[model samples]
Target: MSALPVIDIHTGAAPVLRETVLEFDQVAVQLGGRQILSPTSLKIGRGEFITIIGPSGCGKTTLLRAAAGFVRPEGGAVLRQGRLVGGPSREVAFVFQDYAHALLPWRTVQGNVELALEAAQVPATERAPRAQQVLQTVGLAAHAAKFPAQLSGGMQQRVQIARCLAQQPELMMMDEPFGALDAMTREGLQDELARLVRETGLTVLFVTHDLEEAIYLADRVVALRANPTAERPSLARVIDVNLPRPREQLATKEHPEFLRLRRELYGYLGHGHG
Candidate 1:
């Protein structure tokens, strides 16, 4: 509590906060003439792990896409490292939930991870070592030569993460990345991902429907509300987790603060299917 800057995103937290990595200034979006997000604003600091959760159609994915420059906002703006995010950049890496479609089945694990370096035009010789390093970081070094078809769902997802790491991005956008994994597998990867993000010091904006996942992995949880109006805006609330680092799936989930936050956020999710 003393040194940690787990402060509200929309409020006064800059003094103790790290350098801003991403900023959403009155951001809004619409689809098919319907407003997807209201005028929203949040400042995300470097190395922060922010999780977004809300009901279905609440623009969780839309907000994340906007941050990554994959979606254009109808109003307001998204700034990355003080520059307006007009389009996707090599410094930003996106991790899709569907690992099956995200990875190229024709390529080996190492080859897929090398795609990022290839896109950046890194030398062919440099790509190998970089790809291998990230693969090893994700514990997939032994499976480098294996094809995506040969790996399990969790392993495939790990490859996808490894690929993002190879890009050496300043920000990582994860959209319900563990949503498709089994309960056990999801918990395991949650730990692995938390560890990876900590070690790499990459700022992450993660979207999830799971209440516990949102609480366990976030420095602050941004809860959005669907079908926004002036009375009920899209950005419902942002709560600081304030929990210690290196969260354990079992122990952290059972922590008093964790349970309290879970109970607090459960109401917004409405049966947790969102």
Candidate 2:
């Protein structure tokens, strides 16, 4: 396995804390006889928001799935809170990009959130209040009684997120959760998600194709490459984003560091330069 570089522009910034919540130790994966991910190693600290960005088919989603225990790695291991991830657990909740299909069409928004509790076998008596509280956090309490089809795309996505929050998970794996929404809605949810993560203190491994979104939401960004060999691994770069918190969409994007990081990681996304 090749060594992956961690670029840190913040000399005076805080170092990654010691309380590691997730570790990908030389993890490798193959799908249908093709190596999807080469040996990749990373340690995600507790409450850290790490975003994965790479070109399409660069194993971004595969890596996230491996960490979530949905895809078993062919080599190495994925550990959560110092334990090997055997399979998907209630403690690690996954949010899909396709909100339209993720929710049960027949159920109300409240019922959708409660589905998490139901799947976990959380007591039937406890589901409604717990689901309602989560809905409030995602700003969907007023719409909870409505069905999924009754809400807008963004609202349905919020319902999906609220369901994950209802799970009360320690870790969240979001695979481009806002990729399908319109730009305005996407930006709105990005801020909402950042706040939700802050309030919940949940560790997140989010996958996205948008370079700006990746940098805006991540404490550290992980870049990957496709078609790896022994000399060239799938993992490319891990960069620390030292921008100040309470990031505003307009102001934060204009910040110098944000632009610099965007340019630095821009090549990895395989898009035209700045």
lDDT of each: 0.88, 0.88
Residue 103 of model 1 has an lDDT of 99
Clashes of each: 0, 0
**Which stretches in model 2 have alpha-carbon errors above 4 Å?**
1-16, 272-274
| Cα deviation of 219, candidate 2, in Å | 0.3
Q: Candidate 1's error at 195, in angstroms?
A: 0.7
- What TM-score would candidate 1 get against the native? 0.93
* Candidate 1 weakest lDDT stretch, 10 residues: 1-10
Q: Which window of 10 residues has the lowest lDDT sum in candidate 2?
A: 1-10
Clashing pairs in 1: none
Every model's TM-score = 0.93, 0.93
